[model samples]
Target chain A: MILAYIGLGNMGYIIAGHIADKLKQDGEPTLLVYNRSNAKVDALIADGKHVQSASIDHIARHADIIFTCMFNDEASKQIIGKDMIGSGQMKHGAIIVEQATIRPDTAEFLASIANEKGLHYLTCPVMGAPPRATAKLLVPLLAGNPAQRKIVRPYLENVIGKVVVEVGDSPGSALRLKLCGNYIIVTMVEMIAEALTLGEASGVGQNKVQELLAGLFAGTPVTDYAQRMTDETYDDVRFSLDGANKDTTYILDLAEKSNADIPMAKVFKNHLDKLTSDYPSLDISGVVGVVREASGLPFNLKKA
Target chain B: MILAYIGLGNMGYIIAGHIADKLKQDGEPTLLVYNRSNAKVDALIADGKHVQSASIDHIARHADIIFTCMFNDEASKQIIGKDMIGSGQMKHGAIIVEQATIRPDTAEFLASIANEKGLHYLTCPVMGAPPRATAKLLVPLLAGNPAQRKIVRPYLENVIGKVVVEVGDSPGSALRLKLCGNYIIVTMVEMIAEALTLGEASGVGQNKVQELLAGLFAGTPVTDYAQRMTDETYDDVRFSLDGANKDTTYILDLAEKSNADIPMAKVFKNHLDKLTSDYPSLDISGVVGVVREASGLPFNLKKA
Candidate 1:
């Protein structure tokens, strides 16, 4: 059986690299890899664990099990389109594991097309940043047929994820879960920004605000983001505003299509849009600066 | 120095009982206690530790340091009003530590009146619920004169709080910080509710959603509330919709007063308002039901 990994962005690179390393350590054949950019592919190849595939079609035809971690729907759609699945590139019964934050409808469409060609498709979008993926601490939200899930569970558990949650049999379910998770995370950033802004505006010292948040929020994402907000470390962007904007847009679109009223997501999207327009390169945490500025406080809490 | 504890509600009862027990253990003079309802006062008295004050005025006159943990602005205002602080009921140089969640403006007004009467007032609104207060695990956000802060620091540290954060010299700063903390918490509930609704609507089991949240949110308020949301335990009402609604309103008011654009808080306030109007008796976590309903999912995710 051959294994292939696609996409080489921050998160995708770390996760795919980890899978390849694990497969190599187990004395399996060299893993197959591909990316839109040759630089990431070259970087991975230089590390000496995998063979680079000539193209998406090459991996689709050659690999028994392929994992795709594209940045968004468009990237995934372009690479995993009819040409890859419908054109007889993928052998019948080969499994496709998708691990991107995409809309449920998109996942469903992809699943329908892949199923038509007798190719098994699983939506397994993951949670955590590149660092977590590198540490093999990322959690996968998995949704697929029971047999396909059983086939991929070993790699997801041993090679990449700390926890793999089987959401359901529907392909869209995993994507929806991922979008919902992102919605929570993005909303958390907004809440932290607003809270820190309120604290700074009220003449509470940044250290004290951090202390209170550390005490109250304890082990949550809010505490992690609170440190970033207090330190004004947006320049070291792990997740850019542009990426967050894409996720937020996807979430809002999903909510609209589902007729779910996620007003907090809407509010966050607007705040993010305004902030990203002025400082498009800022990290997702830079929303704190927008919050602080709106409250008439200085941009950086540390400086303030 | 004489010490008094007032307002024996769910949180106030346990916190005052703890303070009184600690003081008794130290062999200090009797701790003075008061509550609007005679039952809680009687319950504490029956626990065989402290003496009950005849009235708020009596505690004001007798205690050198008075700790009030009233429920809201109106309740606190009534007890610490002109008849109490303004009428020279509190002895000169006595200290009043306000631990209730109240508006910063109300705190400032109370401080002004107390100061005029040669009394020191400290806004020391705390984080954590009744159990935390009972365990002396509550974290206090304190703001007052430095000398007064020094005087109360020991009691706040040893008798009640696990950690004490001194925000600033302004009396209302602590209250503002507390409100900000609450805003983050309330907004967290909304985000959790929205995410869970999305998960359920997309056919993700509540257990899987809870697992993902537990892995993602970890030791945060989100995890605790996620458990509550999935169990449909909002009816247990440790923190009621009424209480959350009050805090959200205070946050929105503070934001408006500060000219801060807390759009997330505004969205939360609107959501809470709608939810409370329909299910006034629901726990704060009941906001999840509202979110689920909005998404056309069942009100109880567990049932769904």
Candidate 2:
């Protein structure tokens, strides 16, 4: 069996590495890799991993399955439509698993095209940060036809994740799950921002409020992620606020399509949009900065 | 020194009981108790407690300090201003400690009124519900003059709360702190509601998302309070959605007055408003019900 991997950004790279590592330990299944940036491919080759350099033709000729983990819906569409669709070396009976956060409609559209080409398709988005993926501590969600899901379950087990929750038998099911997970993250940031601002306004130090929060509400990700708000640790940020803004924006867009009113999420996105102005490179948790600013207090305090 | 404790709500009753119990043990100071509806007063009197047939005026004339733990600003003002002020029975050097969640402006206004009448006023709101207060687990924030705060510290120690967080000299500071604390609570609900909705949309069972969240981000109030959201447990509600909506609406009024932009909080309030419409009698945590509706799923499915 052969596996073709595409997209080598932060999440994609970690996942692809895990895939290569798994294949190596499990009798060395043939691996084919592709990225617009060839540097990643060179690095993998230098690491003594066998990576097949496949322009669309070679990937179709050699690989029994392809995994795509692109940035968004547009990127996923561009990669497949522009690069892979018309490659003359097409093979039948192959399956494609998409592990990217994209719109449900986009996933359905792509799955339809793949089905028309006589290929099985699965939407298998994941839940984790780059570090979590690297540590194999990610959560995976698989959604597709039963046969396509079973085909990818083996390689999925090879990756180090805490869960592989299989959902509905639909192309967009997994992506839908990922988007929902992101909605939670942004919502957490928004809540912390307002709470901290209220604390400051009340003349109770943020640290003191945080202490009480950590004690009573000790089991929520909302408070566990407090330092990200209190410390104003944004510049050297792990998750960019801009990225979160994009996700929220997309979620809102989807909500609009579904006619689901998510005023709370929209309000949070507006705050994120405002925050991006002053701290353009701010972390998503930098929303607390906006809160502090609106509270008319000093952004940061100096140690006495 | 005499102390008059008024209001016997779930939190109020426990805290007053703690104070009366402590004072009885100490045998130095006298404790008088009062409640609206006047029906519960007999029970306190029957317990050999200094339960009084007293109006706010009666309490004012007899006690060196009067502590009010009523429900809202209007109730507090009606009891303190109309009844207490109209009776004209307050002595010079007498102090009033308020322990209700009200607008900061109300606190400041009441303080101004008390000052004009040569009365020492302090806004000292207590944190914790009935169970916590019964165990003396509440956190108290004291906002007043140092002299007035000093006079009440010993008595406050008996029943107010465990930790006396000293805010500042502003009469409104304690109320501000209380509002801030509730801000955190409502914001948390908003985020949890949205996150759970998103997670369900992704085909990850709300229960699975809860499990993953508990493992990854289960160290704060946001997640701890989210147990209701995860488990879909909302029947025996502790804090009703009406209460949450009331608090959010109150805080938004303050935010608007202060000209602070609480777009995120505004969104949260909208969600709570929506929830309040459906589950009019549902607990605040019952906002999860609204989320379930948004996700097009059934909630509270008990395991067989």
Candidate 3:
């Protein structure tokens, strides 16, 4: 009945916290947590909930259900391959849940590997930043075996996120859908940036754009990014520009491999490449600053 | 207090109907309505509400607050200049409300002419399609004299639309903001098209994308358009590709004048050009079909 959580990045950290809290509330087995960095592990321990620090070997061998949210495909692959699967580390019939956004082919390959080892693997990549994870506003995409899906469904919805989008059987499907979601988000930022900048440039003011966005696109990411675009509050770095730029790489790669025509995504990637180089420390919404600069305006929209 | 409404296009017809209803409810003057063609006027008269068709000269001379929603600048100018502003056709200190999506300069010029002749001109461009107008979901952008805005604000909100974004004093300001709002919508279509096409091309399917869009953009136009994309419903055009393509002209014109570098809008324009050439009868959301065709797939997402 033991559950294990891995990766302690911003999104992973907040999500793992929710899972531990829910399990502890239900009086389930202690949640085994593992990360290369111990600070997050120590922070989870200090919270003194259901989470306990565990080494990779310990988590894989003991935990009945393991969740991984690593940085990239290669990192997630190594841990699932050399460290866990068929290495006498994980219990038989144990479930491995992947939340990291990796290439569809890579995810498919890993799912096959785990299946061959008498293990169940599922991809459940989520939509939204860490703040959304904290607020339980994230949308998790679930794809894999129906049985494994049923087992982990309790831990996702109303726990770490508000809803779940069942992406169906292929593990690649969830990851590909995750890329499509990211495609919507990043291109949405570009759309917001352009609209706000156009407003400012045309002397209509971003304030009016803000008003229109509130009325037209309320409860969506467009409103969320429009506020940031109008407010000039990018230094907080909730999701770093570097990470957003990295996502464009995967989105473009998926489009390239599939021969999908996503010119909007290409435009976003061009903006991301420029913005990530210029302001790596700002939040991903900093693409607005690039749009402002291209319009020959100052980086900040706030009037002095 | 005579009230006049000119033009009975799909949007204007529904809006004029609402205004006539509101005035009837309040026991005010019967609305003075005028249009070149009398079919819509016949239709309105047949409804047996508080509306009666009148000549342009009669409306100009008698109506205290006149609302005009014409097709283009030239037509609006001919009516405003030759039929309304002066030459003993209109009363002094009257107010003219223009709700057409005309050029910024044309609105400004109309405002200037109306002001010089002791008449008030206000631009009240609205967002949303004719269906939205029917549902009272339209967002109107108002810009003009503050006192004049005060005169018309009551008739706008809760009558034809839910809210009005008061865009500054310059009449052109509202038009500019309207273009910006259009920019957000059309670019949003491009983003949705690219994301759904990417999903289908990658073999993830638009159903998964539809589920994700529902969760991520629940209350926005993205959800509205995503449903159409996933369902392959394009022939029942709510916002025709021709009309959508015309809007891109104003949007690009504004961006060109303002020197705003909106690559997303440019991409949208390119797609609109292609989509309109191919599917003029389809809805503007039919841009998804172009994305699919470019990806070597069928125009529709529904399975055979």
- Which CAPRI tier for candidate 2? acceptable
Across B123-228, the per-residue lDDT of candidate 3 in tens digits comes to: 9989988778989889988899999899899899899887778888999999999999888888888888888889889998877787887787777778889888
Q: Number of backbone collisions per candidate, in order? A: 0, 15, 1
The per-prediction CA RMSD against the true structure, in angstroms, equals 2.5, 5.6, 1.6
Error of 3 at B212 (Å): 1.0
lDDT of 2 by residue, A11-119 (tens): 7777888788878888776478888889887787787775666665677677778898877777878776445654535578788788878888888888888778887
Docking class of 1: medium
TM-score of chain B of each: 0.95, 0.89, 0.95
Candidates' C-alpha lDDT: 0.81, 0.73, 0.87
- Which rank order by DockQ, best down to worst? 3, 1, 2
Deviation from native of the Cα of residue B88 in model 3, angstroms: 3.4
lDDT of 1 by residue, B1-304 (tens): 8989887788878877777777778778777888877988788878886665567778878888888888888877877876578666578899999989998888999999888888888989888877677778888888989999998887778677767888889988888888878877888788888777766665665566678888976765677888888888877989988788788888888778777778887777777888889889988888888887777876774564
Location of the lowest summed lDDT over 10 successive residues in candidate 3 chain B:
B81-90
Report the C-alpha lDDT of model 3 over A1-304, residue by residue, as the tens digit: 8999999888888889999999989999878999999999999989886898999999888988899999988898899866999586678999999999888888888889898889988999999887788898888999999998999999998998877888889888999999998888888888888888999998888888888888887877777788877777888777677678768889999999999999988888888888878887888788888888999898886745
Better of 1 and 3 by DockQ: 3
Q: What DockQ do you compute for every candidate structure? A: 0.60, 0.30, 0.88
